[model samples]
Target: MTDRIEKIVRDRVGEEPVCLFAYDLDRLAEHVRAVVDSLPARCRMFYAMKANSADPLLRALAPLVAGFEVASGGELDKARAVDAEAPVIFGGPAKTLAEIERALRRDVTRLHAESALELHRISEAATRLGRTVEVLLRVNLAGPFPSATLAMAGRPTQFGISEQDLPAAVAAARSLPGLRLTGFHLHSLSNNLSAEAHLELLAHYGRTVAGWEREFGLRCEVVNVGGGIGVNYADLDAQFDWASFSRGLPAVLDEFPAGVREVDFECGRYLVAACGVYAAEVLDVKRNHGVDYALVRGGTHQFRLPSSWQHSHPFTVLEVDEWTAPVPRPELREASVTVVGELCTPKDVLAREVPVERLRVGDVLVFHHAGAYGWEISHHDFLSHPHPEHVFHADAS
Candidate 1:
């Protein structure tokens, strides 16, 4: 930990209790640049704004990233507000015609058409606007991706058009005067930390793109291997093999007739996860049924991962007392306890069976690796507890 963090923790421990989410934009921008730089020459990187739509973070990443992938009009507004010149790719399972019109008016780089109905709608909208719309047909590749196992695998997922419909869809797109089918989009299951799985997905999509190019006599300009790069929440020092991911792209590109137009990667979690920390102060500590539990003011209402995904965040207790030397306090003791939040439900757990250095009431606890999906994905106005305050570190220099 640095002196800045130590001072922030100490100050929070001394002041009135509140949860503060610290964001390190500089470190996050570096990560984004590294991934984009390592890709092939024609590759374009887009930041998935759904991960963390904080204006400050977006402003920091706007200059570093190539484009923004937006799922809704609200996200589009956010991207435009920060990086108006950055290219935008509009994608989602179900989009209103109004939203499609908004995207068309904004001249998004590409609209990922999810279904036949969406294609028709987009074509009509473009025709009304008297302009051609570039689109990527989102294909549902039948494969075993981790996202499939958790949310999309066995369930009826409404993410992309089926593989079986590709032929007809392409033919239909060709007939639509205002719509041009530029490429194919496939977003498989993500949040699984398996590089092999991503490689397999890339290979499958690559072959599919190759086949489409040959059959349609049209070069696939954009091959979007959708985002799902996992973050190192458990161990920040653990290495993520970007080399393995880069190695697989060349073969996928080789199949493109136009010699692989552009590879677009929509990344979210991998870029922002490590740069966020959620700081909360302990409110109460109790022993129940021979197990110790520390209840904090913030709960699932604030951070929903622990209860929803059974995920555990790395936590460190910060003691406010002054010390003459930089040494561990001998008076402090270690204890195994469950860190929970003040929620009405029994499932309001932040960290389960966690070991901390003798937590006490009013002591501040910092949860690490909370940059992505922490506050963006799930937030219920349930308990009326105010949302977590967001703080940005402007100088990660």
Candidate 2:
């Protein structure tokens, strides 16, 4: 893992617990190309810009993806600034009129209405702007599937319109002036591990949309499956099966009724997660009661993915044996350690009970699968800790 990211961190940053993120642009491009080339031409790929709106990252992905899926005005601006021509889709549960107006004025390609009222707001915004706007109804499925780590479907969530309210919402959207229901947004999974489950979810979406078309005589162009593609931080071996998924889409599309020309996968984590790694300097190593703990200079304030997801994040110890300290620090040969941050609470744990060959004070730990939610979603202002440094690496190719 360090082979791909270590030198960039070590050379650019020294001992300060710099929450560094390094991207292999070439690998990222290759992965995006593979996903794009493998999938059917009818399927459109959009990067969920919320994952990591880093300018360089956005610029790199713009050429590869069909568009950018943005939830807020800032994301919309970032997406447009990086690549002015790339289509952007604006959607969220609660969108202020200002946001709606901005999206309309900026000429966003689509607006995904999460609630009935939002449709009216979009209509009003578009009407006031005197422009036609396309919209997709974000549907929250009302049942269960192979379980996900975090669920956005099969329950009462603030994400989308429940199936029961779909008819009224559809009527409302259709009746609203300046609005066109061109598609449906069925995004439920949050960091899903199973490709089978993801495909199953997609199949369910296709079938449900087909049923909608049959029952309500609705015609749509795209089904935006908002990004929740999981990154396996616990075990590197286990990953979302992109190959099988790309292979299975044709059959899945067969389930949908005719007229749906485009299927958009707003993938954020799957595309960018592997490209980043977060490193922090170890300040102390000791035993807390019966548990071994390695305290770092930074805590969840820098990288909150582990705590937010309630999973033991995976990491590697980059032995920074160049200890210039006058006092001798305790060093371990081969032992299990729970790496904690410098936070006041115990909840700052990053990786719990992980096996490491050597860990000592001054050594740095590099957390993998951190590209998605590391800096963007973390509570960096918790203790006024310095924010992580951003580094974009070009492929040697």
Candidate 3:
């Protein structure tokens, strides 16, 4: 935890239990700026709003990213609310006709159609609105993908058009009126960590698109490689090789067919995950069935990434020497403690059997790498638990 966050916890913790999310906007801006600046020519970074859609984070990212990638009508509205004139791309597996009409009305830069039926829907909506819309068909390539935390494609997932159906999708896109087939979107995996493997995947996409252009006699312009860049929750020190990725991207992009103009990346977690922390106060410390457990005031309802990913989240024990209660304070020293939250289900655990030096009842457990997909993906209303406060920190100028 940073000193600012520690100070916030100290000032906020009282008789009531403290559970909140702290965001460092300054750090976010600097990191995003670096990522944007490092990109090679023909590559643009689009912020995937589904990861962390907070107003402040969106505002911070508006000026840095090339545009916003929204997966729903609500996300598109949120993105437009922040910057009406900014470039926006709409992508999702299940898009309603209302959403299609909304995207056409909103003047989104591109619509990523997931299937041939979706292409028909986009064409229908565009024809009704009397507007010509640019579209990219999202393809689920048949692949032996690398090992990652999650895989969105290379299987029978309800994500994108199957590889065998791409030719039909392309034909439909060409035949559909009021629609311009600009490019293809091939986002296969999620939470991919290796830069070399990602580069290899990009090369594969380039090759596949080139073959499609040859076979279908089409001109592909934009390739949206949907963001799956990952954060190492188990080891904070080790992270995705962004520097190597950026340095290597130029050569990888050079391999694309000559007609390909723009390569877009819609990243969410990798952009903002490091700039936030989740802090929860320890409510009780006890041993059950010969296993130590540190029960916290907050649980998976507040931050579900750990439980959802089924990984032991990394955290630090912030010692707070304050005891206002009359009863004795429970302390666990020099042992592995499983951290749990105030939820009814047994699956409300955050970290299991984590080694800690000294953890007391009042000390705050700060979970790192939580800026994106922390509260945004959590089930906040479960069990009617109070929501964690959102605290944004701007650098002291």
lDDT of 2 by residue, 59-164 (tens): 8888899989999999998987887777998877899999999999888999999999899999998999898899999988887866777778788778999989
Error of 2 at 32 (Å): 1.4
lDDT of each: 0.77, 0.84, 0.91
Q: For candidate 1, what is the total of clashing residue pairs?
A: 1
Task: Give the range of the ten consecutive residues with the poorest summed lDDT in model 2.
Answer: 12-21
Task: Report model 3's TM-score to 2 decimal places.
Answer: 0.98
Report lDDT (Cα) of residue 210, candidate 3. 90
| Residue range 98-154, candidate 3, lDDT tens digits | 999999999999999998889889999999999999999999889888878888889
Global CA lDDT computed for model 3? 0.91
Among residues 3 or more apart in sequence or in different chains, the pairs in candidate 1 whose N, CA or C atoms overlap within 3 Å are: 148-153
Error of 2 at 375 (Å): 0.9
Candidate 3, clashing residue pairs? none
Candidates ranked by lDDT, best first? 3, 2, 1
Give the per-residue Cα lDDT of candidate 1 at 27: 72
Minimum summed lDDT over a 10-residue window in model 3 is located at 1-10
